[model samples]
Target: MSEDAEKIIERLAQDLRAGQFTPGSWLKQVDLQKRYGVGRAPVRKALEALAGRRLIRHEKNRGYSVHPADTEEADQVLDIRVAIETGFAEAICRNAVEADIVELGGLAAEFEKIAINGPFHLLYDANLAFHGALLGCARNPAMVALVADLRMRTSPAPASQWLDRSRIERSAQEHYDMVEAVRTSDAAGLARLIRDHILQRAD
Candidate 1:
């Protein structure tokens, strides 16, 4: 993909994260073209990319619209995330080096700092980085690809539901626990921690 297309995708993803695009609202190419000051090609490419990730839907007559959020779908996504993260944590526990643990610790510290800050966007990126770091520790290309797809699918959730500082703090603590479990080579503990951590966020 060209740099412009990549930028368009990132901007659209950010808007989706910020709830700028409401569920079921039609996204006209012309409107997006005007909003982003981009040409038709990049806008269409962005929409197609998001649609491929199931973050948006393209209808025969409606052009494109944000995907409707469903509780059942959210539950399923959470379940998948738990399974992937548990395996990731276990892999890290079994094979992670000192440098891997150090990197994970750094990501955890970043997450804590973001939780201390009021702006949720920082928290969001930190959360992504924490998980991305875990996936990096796994060092499995297939697992990383699957986790990336799942992460994109779950990224458009309403920020209002995740605005509680206490909840964010709890998540940060869970990241710490996960890293400790990996450092100690506690595979079972890492798995349990990941399962509980994901389900807690689903609540």
Candidate 2:
């Protein structure tokens, strides 16, 4: 794909992730073209790429549309996420440096600020940044990429999971605790924290 097509994919993916497009809503090529101010070719390629990612569904006679929320499938994918993300705990602890810890702390702080009053999409973006930085401490690019894709596969509107204010607040605190775990080289503690965060089993 061309660079423009790739950029379009990311932009459309962001919109999907942010819940701007309702689940099961058709993504028309002309509408996408108008929204992104791009050509039909790029929109078509972007929609195809998103469909391949399972972020959207493709029909034989129809074009692409957002996948409807599936609780069972989302739960199954969340299990996979818990396994892979928690598995990264030891590597993340071993490889994380003081600078990385500080960066994570900053990201956590940013998330907390956003969680208090920011829009859902911004809060989601902050959450992603925190987790992305935390995972990057593992220094495993493949794991990071795979986990990211799995996250998108969990639900068509992942940001909808943050709709509860109390849950969002707890998540903000969890981010800080995760940073502390990395700072202290607490792999076991980090693993447990990650598992709880992913499963939302933390109190």
Candidate 3:
């Protein structure tokens, strides 16, 4: 893909991640073009790229649409996440600095603050920011990108994951615990926490 196309793909993917488009909703080329302020070619290329990534679905005459939530698929993706993220704990703890811990703590606090009454999107964004920062501590961009793509595949809409305010609050506390685990360089503890956090949702 061309540089322009790559940029468009990232932009469009971010929107998809943010739930800008509902799952199973059709993506019109004209709407995408207006949204990204790009020409037809780049939008088309971006859609094709995303489709290849399994971020969206493509049909013969229907063009592209978001993948609707699938329980089995989501569970499988969550299994992959637990493996990757928990395995990454040691590296993350080794590479994390005070600054990284502080950043994570701040993000965790932000999420906790909004867990009870904030708008769903903001709460979701806060949760994403916290995890993105946590993953960055590992200093593995490739792994981080893969995890992000997997997350989008499993949970196309953030609202679907929130479920209830109590669950959201539990997730918020887990974020703080994750930061603390990093701070203490408790790799094993972090791994357990990561596994529990990912698997608890499926319970």
Measured by lDDT, the strongest candidate is: 3
lDDT of each: 0.77, 0.84, 0.87
lDDT of 1 by residue, 25-107 (tens): 88999998888888999999999998887777798866998766654676788788887787676677877899988999999
Task: Kindly provide the TM-score of model 1 when superposed on the true structure, using C-alpha atoms.
Answer: 0.85
The list of candidate 2 runs beyond 4 A from truth reads: 1-3, 117-121, 155-159, 201-203
- lDDT digits (tens) for residues 70-112 of candidate 2: 6577788899989998998999999999999999999999988
Q: Candidate 3, residue 31: CA error in Å?
A: 4.6
Candidate 3 lDDT tens digits, 101-132? 99999999999888876866688778778998
In model 1, which regions exceed 4 Å deviation? 1-3, 117-120, 155-158, 161-163
Going through the candidates in the order shown, the clash numbers are 0, 0, 0
Arrange candidates, best TM-score first: 2, 3, 1
> Could you tell which candidate, 2 or 3, scores higher by TM-score?
2
Model 3, residue 66: distance off in Å is 1.5
Per TM-score, the best of the predicted structures is 2
Models sorted by lDDT, best on top: 3, 2, 1
Deviation (Å) of 111 in candidate 3: 0.8
